[model samples]
Target: MASCIFCKIVKGEIPSFKLFESDKTLAFLDVQPLSRGHALVIPKHHGEKLTDIPDEYLTELLPVAKKLAIATGAVEYNILQNNGKGAHQEIGHVHVHMIPKPRPEQGLGIRWPTQPTEMDKLKELHEELAAKMQE
Candidate 1:
């Protein structure tokens, strides 16, 4: 956490264009924005991933993101959060991106690689997950 940029931002060790802040969360303009009005919402708690954050710290995360989206006057946008490096999370902290999609070419563009649905495999997987959830 001492070396984390987000943690530094939260601590005012690194200056940021802060938009909103609460005890549990912080919203600021992204320095390397994907599009206009792009912002980063992060929990004040130092968490490497979603599951690492406490529930109390997470309570204001989405609400801050929603506020950022509305404040940006974004008609279309992407609320993005990635976990691991393979998932495209550059920072070692939990943060959500509110990227305003002003045009088709801008903001977060995603490609959904769809796979063929196999009912038997899907049922078996679902049952396994369901049983785990009960435990």
Candidate 2:
């Protein structure tokens, strides 16, 4: 937490183009943006993954994200939550990227390649996930 940029922003040690702030969360413009009003919504407390935060805390984040998305006049958007480095997470803290997809000219979407997978493999994964969810 001492080294986290988001924590620094929350503490006012680092300057951020702030959009919204609540007791439990903070939303701010991304310094390096993918779109005109790209923002990052993060928990005020240090949480490294979705599972690390309580359900109540996580649920509250959506409305704040929505408000920022609408305030920025985003025609379309993606709420991307990255968990860890293996999933392209650059920072250790949990933050949702509010990428405003205003136009194709901006090239801000769906670029990650997907490949077809076997149905049996999908079924196996689904079964495993379903079992885990029940725990």
Candidate 3:
């Protein structure tokens, strides 16, 4: 993926405020940051979605993300991953959005409208997901 920006960053062809790097992954400050320590965690290998990466790689990526969140003094954080074009994934390469939510007044403010799901629906959805996990 020569055209991918994240690949370029990983290759050192593009400059990034790099925070951490491993053999398989790179963590860097987002150029267009939403907050003081906003960062993007990406795989060294180019992939368009989470499922594209092997399970072992994903296992390694999460702990690094947690370390980054703690190091950045994030009181709360959002781990956002967009899968496709319809989901607003502007970058062609897959990356995790590590948004540090230090305060409600700072960073990206999300207004989540809560709607109560029916108990029957919740039970059915849970069962469906649980079955998938067992497979």
Could you say which candidate leads in TM-score? 1
Residue 52's lDDT in candidate 1: 96
Candidate 3 local lDDT, 18-68, one digit each (tens) = 989988889999888888888888888788988888765566577777888
The alpha-carbon lDDT assigned to residue 38 of candidate 2 equals: 86
The count of backbone overlaps in candidate 3 is: 0
| Every model's TM-score | 0.96, 0.87, 0.85
Candidate 2 lDDT score relative to the true structure: 0.85
Off by over 4 Å in 2: none
Candidate 1 structure quality by residue, lDDT tens digits, 28-103: 9999999999999999999999999999998988888999899999999999999999999999999999999999
Q: Give the TM-score of candidate 2.
A: 0.87
Candidates ranked, most accurate by lDDT first:
1, 2, 3
- Superpose all Cα atoms of candidate 3 onto the true structure and report the RMSD in Å to 1 decimal: 1.9
| Each model's lDDT | 0.95, 0.85, 0.85
Please give the RMSD to the true structure for each candidate, in Å: 0.9, 1.8, 1.9
lDDT of 2 at 52: 86
Q: Tell how far residue 13 is off in model 2, in angstroms.
A: 1.2
Q: After superposition, how far is residue 97 of candidate 1 from its true place, in Å?
A: 0.4
Ranking by TM-score: 1, 2, 3
The worst-scoring run of ten residues by lDDT in candidate 3 lies at 54-63
